[model samples]
Target: MPRSIWKGAISFGLVTIPVKLYSATEEKDIAFRQVHASDGGRIKYRRVCEIDGEEIPFPEIAKGYELADGRMVILEKEDFDNLPLATTKAVEVVQFVAEDEVDPTYFNKTYFMQADGPGTKPYVLLRDALVKTGQCALVKVALRSREALALVRPRDGLLVMHTMLWPDELRSGEFAAPPETVSVSDAEVTMAQSFIEALSGDFKPEEYTDAYREALEEVVQSKASGVAMPEQTEAPKEAEVVDLVAALRASVEAAKKRRAEGSAAATG
Candidate 1:
């Protein structure tokens, strides 16, 4: 089993259910290291004190917050440990609301919440209630010394917590919006609808693979073996759609053709 990163309690009304938090997702991207091209020496970093111009030890390093007037306020590890916040070691449920009420963009990281020894009963009760009601709990919790807003919901017999970005953290998209003067005809809208319908299907995440990562791995293998690298294909060029309706119609036809080919391959 994976080791739990955090131990906390879920404050469900007056009942406190002890729980352990585990990370739900991990990145599979290939890692690269910065090194001397000629000798393959690994790069390193050092911490130096600016005021005294001396190398600083890890224990002596402290976090500093810069002020608007250019003054730095140094804060020690002890300062964060003693903060007056109840959510520091607890999952305080604020309210339960319909799951659709929360936007997907607000979600950040995901973690699994497992009940501790005595709290298992209450955890099951809460999970069942959420599943039946189709609601998710809005909560406050602290992880890695930072407080966050999160949503807790039942998934595959486990309680999952998704940390959320604050409202102010989301920037306005007004600058990226198209001008109000731009408009589309009814026929163009219908064609776009057809394209969407042709391409729509149940989401199967496992069917997808990281093509770029696979290609990068092949390149690295070729270099290590002193073999010739695979020949590269020309990148696709974007079409300049002068007629929007014609482009939409073509897209719909292409989507339908692909779907038909996929179905035929599966049957054969």
Candidate 2:
């Protein structure tokens, strides 16, 4: 069983469902640490005051908000507690909207919501209802010392709470306008459509691999084994000017050849 990161409850109306939050994803990439080159000692950072040039302890650090230029209002723990909010240890569902209505770009991190105690029946019912309706529960949840908007939906047999980005945080109209109306040759259009049909296949996430990461790992392993490294060769540059139709034709042909070879290899 996965470890629960947070313990909370879902509150809708007067009913409260006790639940625990668990991480839905894991990082698998390699990580590095900063170290002194000469002594091989790890480097560390300290929070220090710029004016006094003195290290500030965690206890001395107080939350502050700048109201104007060079002016800040320091807030203590008690001051923050007085702020008006639901403050309930529950994820309060505000409304339910069609899942398609929510932009995918608004999604942030995700966490699994598991029932804490003997509330399995209600939890399962909620999950099933969400799946059947194809809707997501927009909720307000307070976690990690802040309030956040979360989308609750069913994934597998569990409820997943995905933190949503604020509307102001999302930029509008970043895409370019559609090209001006243009005429296309019937033969060109037919060939392009045929090429698309020939190259199309079911999307498979597992088929994608990070070649750069694999190469980096191989280099690291070789260095660790004291193997001699080969001299690197620079790849040739692509043409600055390209004929779109010609390029598309070449790509389609290459894809067809690759697929045929793969099929033949499997049969062999």
Candidate 3:
């Protein structure tokens, strides 16, 4: 079993349920190490103190807070352990709201919450209630020395927490909006709707693969085996739309043709 990263309690009104938090996702990206290209020797770095120009050991390292006037305050582990925030051992539920009300842009990481100690019954109660009402609990939690806004909801008989970004952390997009003069006609919109409808289907995440990562891996394997790299194909150029309605109509027809071919192949 995967080890839990955090141990805490969910404050359900006056009742408290002990829970363990585990990360719900894992990354599968290809990683590279820095090395001397000529000799294939691994590169190394040291944590050197700026003031003394001396290498510092891991045990001597402490968290530093730089003041506006350039003063540095070094804090130890005890300082963080004694922080005034209640989020240390508690996932404080502030309120419950409709899941759809939360914007997707604010979401960061997801973690699975499992019932611990004698909290299974209360955990199930909360999960079932959330599932029935289609709501999620807004909560505050602290993980890895930082407090965060989070949403707690039920998923497949389990409680999941999604960490959210603070409002100020989101960037304003006022500069990126299209100018007032840019507009689409009714006929173009209608054709675009038809095109979207033709291509609409249930999302199947398993159907997609990371083509770039796969190609990169093949390239690395070829170099390791002293074999020639695979020839690259030219990517299709994007069409510059002079007539929006014409482009939309062509897209709709192409989508329809693909759907018809797929259905025929399935039947055959």
| TM agreement with the true structure for every prediction | 0.94, 0.81, 0.95
TM-score head-to-head 1 vs 2, winner? 1
Each model's RMSD to truth, in Å? 1.6, 3.3, 1.4
Candidate 1 residue lDDT tens string, 1-268 = 9999999899999889999999999999999999999999999878887788898999888899999999999999888888899998899999998889999999999999999999999999999999999999999998887889999999999999999999999989999999999998898888888888989999999979999999999999999999999678999998898998899888888888988998999899
Ranked candidates, highest lDDT first: 3, 1, 2
Tens-digit lDDT track of model 2 for 203-262: 988989888778788888888999977878999997754565776687689889999998
| The 10-residue segment with the lowest total lDDT in model 1 | 44-53
In angstroms, give how far residue 202 of model 2 lies from its true place.
3.3
Worst 10 contiguous positions by lDDT, candidate 2? 79-88
Query: What total of clashing residue pairs does each candidate reach?
Result: 0, 0, 0
Candidate lDDT (C-alpha), each: 0.93, 0.83, 0.94
Q: Clash number for model 1? A: 0
Against the true structure, candidate 1 reaches a TM-score of: 0.94
Best by lDDT: 3
lDDT of each residue in 55-85, candidate 3, tens digit only: 9999999999999999999999999989998
